[model samples]
Target: MERKSSSSMRLPPAVQAAALAAVGGSRLQKEFAWMSWAGTVWRLEGQSGAVYVKRAGDLKDERDRTVWLAGRLPVPEVLGLFGGFGDDWLLTRAARGVPLSDPSLGWEPSRVARRLGEILRDIHALDAAGCPFGERKLGHVLIHGDYCLPNVLVVDGRLSALIDLGLAGLGDPQDDLAAGVWTLQYNFGPGHAREFLDA
Candidate 1:
């Protein structure tokens, strides 16, 4: 039987080539997760830097725009976009930090949480500009919606950038904050619950 249509299908050859064209290079790697649609992320290597491809008409448009608008705040640079009709993709430079699951994380969970709080505040502080990207409006300030350690990138003990922001959008900042607290509680486990919640 055919699978549900709402789910993302792999990009065909022409579609992939068009993405490559849009991003200005051949594909380097693809990022995926169970919660996200397939082929939503494509990484291409170019002489100048890396390019991240995102299919257009993808629901992720909001996050892309938010990150681009909040460029000074902290996010990977969006180079350009391609495709349409839900086939659109974006090209962006790669960030430098390793994932939060890195062994070193055990040494810095609390520090990471605090820094993440500061970064979240910066993103939430953007004044409402007449956004051209057509993203959902932040009733207060834009929130990443999924502000977890895994999504926060750090380098040289500094928060370098944020990724998996397609989930980013307008919402009560508490929604993101609560999730951050819960994620910390869950991942660290047991006795750390209160500490995480307090964060």
Candidate 2:
């Protein structure tokens, strides 16, 4: 299938309005990457701090989940939420530091893999009862749902926050671990599968 660049896509009117309001005087920059789901993200920076605006099809509600998880997890702060016109828009304060995708980090696969493991372990250890959205009997704690290198932020060798919480909720730990490994392989190399698993 052909992939469409985010630069070519436009946000719905309602979503655009919400993003503009959240950004205020911030400068908005379009992030040219396709979401696993039909969505696009824009980065806004200003005196307050950086913020990210995302627009997704209204198939599910990620805004509420992100807001509910704010004090409980290392995730973005929901600056605004808007729904209408068949799209859901979420504006969040940017996670401090760079995503694992930052080449300036110059981290080897092992280091990234180890960090991924550590962060995932911490996430799985959180008290699921504290999650307001509720959970399943999956025998594990909350999951990032979309645990991947790009979705994770690291600052000075420590996990700063998690992004793309649209898919997050309670589930088996293995699911997140598997997805993490898959993303590691995709971003690094096939060998990264073993390296991440070993990490």
Candidate 3:
């Protein structure tokens, strides 16, 4: 990831103050490579630790789902959520892992595919008895709605954390399965999709 001085970008005053308070410092770095139309992500490192701040049009859904999944699965801790300048800023402690999309990690294709399948299975197995979002239908189960490679983090070759929960909720298992297959193919090539689905 490319890091640029935070001064290059401008954040709403209230959002900037909240991020500074959460990180306990004024030093901030922006991950320009991760910026997208959906939102912009920044990293703040300080004596307290490293935290990530994401600014988007709205993040209440992500905050709510992440909080709901706290004990059930691995996810970043919600440090703070602030709203200002017609945008929502979400602050979360950095997860301890690298995204599977990082090619420099040198992960083997077959192993990565299998691991992704295992992690997705674990997510789907969670009971959704009282899940606040998504319709409670007969076959619904908890799912990582955007189960793409970048959303999954790997540490020591094992699944460590899942992020971007804005679209997560109780839903058809196929939704995650299909996304997993697509991401595996997109990242590792066509032959890995079947390995992921069959793992």
Candidate 4:
């Protein structure tokens, strides 16, 4: 299904202040999360560093999962979290490199497929014992439940970071595997999907 763009939705005033505070009152804020349905992301270039501020409604499980996985995974560091009127904003350091969805990167389909495969394999191989939400006895590892192409960032042709962790929890590993394959096919076509499965 086609998703609607949030290009027209300007960040609410409260959210903007929160973002500015996150970076010590920096004024450089750019809207960047165009395709996201869960929330709006702002790229804030502060005096100290760059951070991506995510504003969402009823965060539910996303906040906890992010905090839990911060030191254990290659995710962005959560600098702060604020809640107001049933909405929440998450401030995190900017992820390194470009997202796999960036067409300008000109990555070959097969190469992207291979990298995604390796990422999934590595994630599934992590020790579930340390995962607060994983049910290890059920053969579930800490899977990126939304392991789609856009959620993965590639740096120098390798998986650098994984974003969007609201759905991450104990579940069948195949869910992540299938989502990865589906994303490959959706983004690069059938040949790429086949290559990913084969790899």
- The model with the greatest TM-score is 3
lDDT of 1 by residue, 1-199 (tens): 0122233336556545644554455553344322344344555555345555555466356445546655555677765554567766555667778655456755556655566566667777776465443255536456776777777787776777777666565567778778777766665653443444444
Backbone collision tally, model 4: 0
Between which residue pairs do clashes occur in model 3? Answer: none
Per-candidate alpha-carbon RMSD to the true structure: 6.0, 3.3, 2.4, 2.9
Q: Indicate the TM-score of model 3.
A: 0.89
Which has the better TM-score: candidate 2, or candidate 3? 3
Instruction: Give per-residue CA lDDT, model 4, range 1-199, as digits (tens).
Output: 2343334446556656755666665575464654467786767665556777777786647777888877767887776677767787777778897877778789788888888888788887776566777565667777989998888888887777888898886779889989988898898778777666666
lDDT of each: 0.58, 0.72, 0.82, 0.75
- Runs of candidate 4 with Cα error greater than 4 angstroms are 1-18, 21-26, 134-137
In model 4, the clashing pairs are none
Least lDDT summed over 10 consecutive residues: which range in candidate 4?
Answer: 1-10
| True-structure RMSD for candidate 3 | 2.4
Question: How do these models rank on TM-score, best leading?
Answer: 3, 4, 2, 1
Candidate 2 per-residue C-alpha lDDT over 1-199 given as tens digits, one digit per residue, 9 for 90 to 100: 0234446446556655555566565334556544556377666555444566677767245777777678888788776766767777677777787788677899998788888888888888887785655457748579888888888898898888888777677877888999988887877877666656665
lDDT of 3 at 189: 77
lDDT at residue 154 of model 2 (Cα atoms): 86
Clashing pairs in 1: 52-92, 54-89, 54-90, 55-88, 56-86, 56-87, 56-88, 56-89, 57-86
In candidate 2, where is summed lDDT lowest over 10 consecutive residues? 1-10
lDDT of 2 at 26: 38
